[model samples]
Target: MEFHEPVMVREVLSVLRPGPLSRVVDGTLGTAGHALEFARLIGSQGILVGLDRDPAMLAIGARRLNEAKGKDGPRLHLVARPYEEICEVLQDAGMTEGVDAILLDLGVNSLQLENPERGFAFSKEGPLDGRFNTEAQATTMADLVNNASERELADWLRDYADERLARPIARRIAARRALAPLRTTTELAELVREAYPPAQRFGRIHPATRTFQALRIAVNDEMGSVERGLKACMSALAPGGVLASISFHSIEDRITKRIFQGATDAKPDPSNPYSATTTEGLEFELPFRRPIACTAEEAESNPRARSAKLRAIRRMEVTS
Candidate 1:
C-alpha cells in the first residue's frame, strides 16, 4: 500500500498539545503519523498508545514507530482494536483515569482506499468486500448489493448511504443482480454508472462516488461509530485533557460540533441540541465555540483536507 500523507497534521498537533508527563491515545493509528507526532511532543516521560482495528495496519504502524528516533521511538504502545472500545482498552492498560490527549481522524484510511484488494474505492477493480478488518463478521459491500431487496437497497442508499438517487440506483442494482450477483467493485460501479447518462458519468468526477461512500458508511456504520467513539474518547481524557476529531462529512461534523459546543457550555441557541445542558450533566467542555477547518494553504496542498472539519474539547473534571 502507498504511504498516505496524514491530513491536517499541523492542526491535529496543535489541538493535541502534549508535554512531558502526558500520555496520549491515538484511537485510530492508521500509519502512526499522529501517534509519532504526539509521542514526540510528550517526550520520554510520556507514553503514547496507538490503536487500530486492522492488524495489518497495526503491524505497519509498529514498524514505523520502531524505526523512529528520539522521543517518538519506543515510548509508543500499539494495540489492534476499534476506537469504540477505547475506554475498555485504556482500562485494560491501567490508564483508565485518562490520558493527556486523544485524537481520532475519522473515515477510510489512505492505505485502505488505495488498495483495490481492500475494496474501499470504486476507482479500483477488486472484490466488493469493504470490511476494515477481513476477520470482522460483518457482511461486505457485495452481500448488501447482491442479497438485499430493491426496497432494502433503496433504504440503505437513501438513509444510511445518503445517495440522492438511491431509489433508482437500487432498482437498477436489483435488476442486474437477478442476472448475476454484484461481486466486484467494477461490477457495482458499472451498475451505478449505467443508471446515469453518459454525460453524468463523464462529469467532474464519477457519479458513483457518492453512492460508493454511502455504501461504505453503511457497511461500516461509520457515522454511528463516530458518535459512540467520540463519547468514549471524551470520557477517556484526563483533567484538562484535549480530544480532537476530524470529520469528513456534514453528518459526522454536525455531531462533532454539537458535542463539542455542548460539552463546553457554549451552544449557540435554542436550535443547538444541548444548549441547556451543564458541565455537571455532561462529559467535557469545548475549547472552541465553532468547528475549525483546514487553512487555505493546507487545503491547497491536500485536497482531501478541504472537507475536513475539526472540533476539540477539554476535560474539566474526571467523572467518578
Candidate 2:
C-alpha cells in the first residue's frame, strides 16, 4: 500500500531545524516519510521517537526507518501509541529531559483514505468501519450509523463536518435505517446525497463528502485526539525546542492555532487590569505571524496540499 507523500517537507524542515544529536518526535509518523528526513538531520547520535495509533502503520514505519537508518543513524524508538501519550512515551523511553522537536501531521493519511477496506472514502465500496485502530476501538462507523439517534447523528454531522444539511441527512438516515442498517460506504453516501435538494445534489463537491468526513471524525474522535495531542506536545518540548503541526482542514487548524496562540500570547489578570501580572507566562513564541500554505507548485503537484496549512512554535529559553 502506498503511504501518504509527506506534505510541505521543505517548509516543515525549515521550521523544525533539527540538528545532530537533537532529540525529535514524529507524532504522526505515516510510513516514516518525514521521520526519515529527521533521522538524517539528527544523525547517528540523535534520538527519534515515532508514534502512531495504528499497529499497521507502526510496523510499516519501523521497516522503512530500519532500511534507511543502516548502521550509523539516530537511535530509533517506534511506539504503537497515540500522539496524545507523548509525555508517557518519552518517560517510558527514559527521555525525561524532553525532545528538541516534535511534528504532528494531523488528519487521515493516504494509506487509510485510498484503501477501500479502511472505509474512509465515500466514493468507495467498503464496510462501514472507520476506526484507525480497529483492534482497540470497540465502536465503528457501522455502530455509529446504525445505533445513534437522529439527534446524535445530526449533532455530529453539524459539529464535526459543518455539514449544512445535517438535519435533513440525519432524518434520511433515520428513515432508512428503520428498515435496514447502513452497512457500506456507498450506502451511507447515497443516503446523504438523497438528503440534499435536487438542485444542490450535484454541486462541485459530492453531497456525501461532509457527511463522510463527519462520520470518520466521530468514529475516531479525531478532533479530541488532536486537541489533547497538541497540548501534550507543547508540554513535552524542551527549552528552545520547536513544535510543528500540519492540519488538513479548518477545524483541525483552529485547534492547533488556539493551543499555539494560548502558549505564545499572554493575558492580563481579570481581577486587576492595571497590574503588570499576567495570567499566562510567555513560554512559547510563534515562529511566523501567519500559518504557511503549500506553494502553488506543490498544490498543483499534490492535490491534497491545497488545503494543508503548516504552523510552528518554539519554546523560549529559560534564564535564572
Candidate 3:
C-alpha cells in the first residue's frame, strides 16, 4: 500500500537545501518518502542514505528508488538499521568525514499503522506486537499486557504516555489478562473502554490511544534511543551540516525542542538563566526561532500532518 504524504516536505526542503555533493541521511527512512525528495534535490552529484530498522520498509524503499530512476538519481544507500546506530552505518559506508544533512522523523509511520500485521494501531484487530523492527527481539505489547503487574503497567502508562487513567486501565488489563491473555488490539481497546467511566468511554478519541502509544514506544525503546540518536546525528554532520527531525507528539517534540534550544541557550542554573554554553564554535543554531509547522492546506489534505512539528539545528561554521 502507498504510504501517506510525508509531513512538512516543503519546509524540510527549504531548510535543508540539498544540492550537489550534499551527503544526507534519512534516519527513519519510512518508505523513503523524504528520501525520494532528497534524491531529487541532491541530484546525481550528491548522496542520500536511507536507514530503517524494518527490513520490510527497506525493501519498499529500495523499490521506490529503483522506480524513480535510481541509476540517474543521486547515489542512494539504503541500510536496514535504526538511526541510533548511524555512526556504524556511516563508517561502513566510508563516510567517516561526515554528512551535510540528517533527518530523524519520530513517531509511527503510516506504513506500520495501515498494515495490521505489525499491530501498531488499536483501530484494527491484530497481534499486539508494536515493535518498529519485527526482528528487534524486544518486549512486545502483548508481553507487557500479559506479564506486567498492574502497578508496573500503570507506572509505565503514566511515565511513558502520561496516561491519566493509567491505574484504572492497568487494573482492568491485569484482571482481563488473568481471565485470558489479551492477544489483539481490539481486545485491549475494549478493556480500556471498559475501564473508563461511561461518560468518558465514548469520548472524541479511543480510550486506548495513549495506552497503544505508550506500549509502542516502550516496545521499541524509542525514548531510550532519542538522546543517542540526536548526539549521533550531530556528531556525524560535517561543518555547517543541518540536522532536522519531525516529531508527531509532544513527548518527542519536547525532547527535540529542549535539546535544540539547550545547545545554544544552556548556562549556569541560577545566575545566568539565559546563558547558553557553546562548544568550540561548533554549537548548533536553531535556523527557525520556533518549530516549523505544516500548512493548513497540508493538514486538511493529510490529517497526519496536523500533529507534525519540525525542528532543526545547524552546526556552526569554523572561523579563524
lDDT of 2 at 171: 92
When 2 and 3 are scored with lDDT, the better candidate is 2
Tens-place lDDT per residue, model 2, 1-320, is 47778899999999999889999999998788999999989999999999999888889889999999987789999999999999999999999998899999988888888888989888789999988899999999999999999999999999988899899899999999999999999999888888888998899899998888999999989998987888788889998999999998788988777777766656633443222221145388888968999999999999899999999888889989
Clashing pairs in 1: 264-286
Could you tell me every candidate's TM-score relative to the true structure? 0.91, 0.93, 0.92
lDDT of 2 at 288: 93
Give per-residue CA lDDT, model 3, range 129-170, as digits (tens): 988877766778899889988898898799878899999898
What residue pairs clash in candidate 3, if any at all?
none
lDDT of 1 by residue, 103-131 (tens): 89888888888889989888989999888
Poorest stretch of ten by lDDT in candidate 1: 274-283
The lDDT per prediction is 0.80, 0.88, 0.83
Rank by TM-score (best first): 2, 3, 1
lDDT of 3 at 236: 83
lDDT of 3: 0.83
User: Candidate 2: where are CA atoms >4 Å away?
Assistant: 199-204, 268-282
Our model 3 lands, by Cα RMSD against the true structure, at 2.6
